[model samples]
Every structure is written in C-alpha cells, then in structure tokens.
Target: MAVARLGTVVLDCPDPLALAAFYAEIIGGKAEETEEGWVELTGHEGTPLAFQKSPGYVPPRWPAEDGSQQFHLDLTVEDLDAAETRVLALGAKAVDAGDPVRTWRVYTDIAGHPFCLCAC
Candidate 1:
C-alpha cells in the first residue's frame, strides 16, 4: 500500500513566477502566484508543478562527470523538432552532450534547470 498520496512536484528557482510562466508555456497551464511568493502552474493535466522562491539559487550542472544533475523533468512530445524550436525561443538553452543517437534532447530553462523533450 502507498504511504501517502502525491501532492505536487515543486521546483526551487530564483524567480518562481518566471519559471512557472516558462513551464506553463510548454505544458499548457496558467502561472498563478500565491501570497507566499510561490508560483503554481494550474489547470493542467497530470501531476501539478509548482515553483518555490529560492534565494541565491544555483542551478545544477548537467552531463557532469560528478553527477551534478540532482533531478530533471522529462516531457514527452509528439514532435521533437517543433518542441525544441519552441523551447529554444522561450530561452531554453540546449545542452549538447555530443550523443547524436538519442530520442530525447536535453535543455535548460531560463533559470538553468535541466529538462528533456522526449519523443512520444
């Protein structure tokens, strides 16, 4: 049996509202800020995604030999090329680890958190 029900997945970032807006664009949600300064992406299907304000935030490094990537979100999309283009336009920088053959491409958000757009 499960110990508890999952509530929401929260990410720590410098600007909660900004990060929320960025993910909202990609995942189809409305970025709503709370009185506590935390931002939540609402009205989307699946598990909820929220952002918390973290002062002096330092984003994790991806593809590091030391395994610096603490965590990452894998977003499945119908069109990988289109999604990559759109995310890049939204200030997502691509992380080229030099692996040519792969179904998923890595990218970092404006706040520098690593994420991937996997082909569905």
Candidate 2:
C-alpha cells in the first residue's frame, strides 16, 4: 500500500566528496565519487546517503527563529558519550550539549548540517 520506497537522502553541499567522507566515517560506509559533483556512500547499515555539489551552498542555522534547520538526521548509538567524543574529533561542532538526563545530543557536520546522536 506504500506509494514508493525511499531511495536515498541526498544533501547539497559545496563539496560532495568531502561531505560524503565525513558521513562515511560516522555511518560505516564507503564513499565513491560516481560522477562530477556527485558522490554516493554505500555499504552502510542504514539508509544510503548521497551528496551533491552546490555552487553557493549556505548552511542552515540551528535554534533559529524561523526554523532554519530544515531537516536533521537522528543517529542511534549505544553510548552517547563515546559517540560524542568520536564525532567531535571528526570536525563536528557541538550545537547543543544536552543535559546529563537527556538521551540525545546535537551536532553540526563539516557542512553545518544538524544531526543528533541519540542513545539507544
């Protein structure tokens, strides 16, 4: 009864290869540049992700009044602390350091896209 199945989540960034590499590190995928200005990450656990080159890419701002964060990815992890440490070292900037009781923490990728590491 579903209209269609999900194909892939594509993001527009300045450099497709670089963004794909960043996500590949977090999601256990191998990034391959399939075509000019386009890169695909495969062999990952979850849904596939692809990156496309944008000439004048401007990242969205978090906690904006107008909901600048159009969308975000929620990644499930076992240990939030351990995952936080690894993502930080991979050039992800912390957007919100959730409280101790919180189950999720927010961060921005190299391209400034918001994503959450949720404790599972």
Candidate 3:
C-alpha cells in the first residue's frame, strides 16, 4: 500500500469567474481561465483553487432555520476575532454557533457553504 495526502476542496458555484473572484480576493490570488465555466486560482501555495460553473446552482440554505447546512469548511486560525472580522467584512454570515464560537465561529461563504475559523 502507498501513503496519501490531502488535496483540494472543490465547491460547486454558480459562476466560476464570480466565485473565483470572491475567493481570489479573500485568499490573495488570481484566477486563470480554463474553459467557459471553469477557472482556477494558482497562488494558494500548496494547492490551486478551482471552480466550475453550475447554471442551476442554488446556494446552500444553511441551518434548518432556512434550509440546511449540508457541508462546511473548517479553517484553522491563530486569532478568532481577527479571522471572524476579516471573513465577516468579506461577506461571510455570522450565525449562532455558541460552543464552536468559544474558539471558532462558523460562517457561510458567498455560496453559503459553512466554514469554521478556529485556533490554529
């Protein structure tokens, strides 16, 4: 048997360009086109961020309050306040995630996939 390592996390989006822009700005990179509905950002250091178009894309409803949170991204951070502030400014929604918020806050991306910022 051979060992393996972590790769990229791909989240479907409505518009690759637009979603790429949101991620590029938030992560500090540039999106390079591959096709009509596909683009990639190549400055992520370890792995490239990729986006694909889904015309029928419907943002995740998040929480039973609206719909439901199907999945989420957990990001490790050094400072909770700083990370939350930055993501919040960048349009991430802050919902009640009490226990998790003690060390991290769960926020939704522009597409509504929940992501967590925690002490790294």
Q: Using TM-score, give the best candidate's number.
A: 2
Per-residue accuracy of model 1 over 5-119 as CA lDDT, tens digit each: 9999999999998999999999998999875769999999889999999997888888778777888999999988899899999999999623556789999999998999988
What is the total number of backbone clashes in candidate 3?
A: 0
- 1: Cα error in model 3, Å: 2.5
For candidate 3, the 10 contiguous residues with the lowest summed lDDT are: 95-104
Error of 3 at 112 (Å): 1.3
Candidate 2, poorest ten consecutive residues by summed lDDT: 60-69
**RMSD list, candidates in order:** 1.6, 0.9, 3.0
All candidates: TM-score: 0.92, 0.96, 0.77
lDDT of 3 by residue, 34-73 (tens): 8888888877664667888888887776575865577776
Q: Global lDDT for candidate 3?
A: 0.74
Model 2, span 68-96: residue lDDT tens: 68989999999999999999999999999
Better candidate by lDDT, 1 or 2: 2
The global Cα lDDT (0 to 1) of model 2 is: 0.92
Choose 1 or 3, whichever is better by lDDT.
Answer: 1
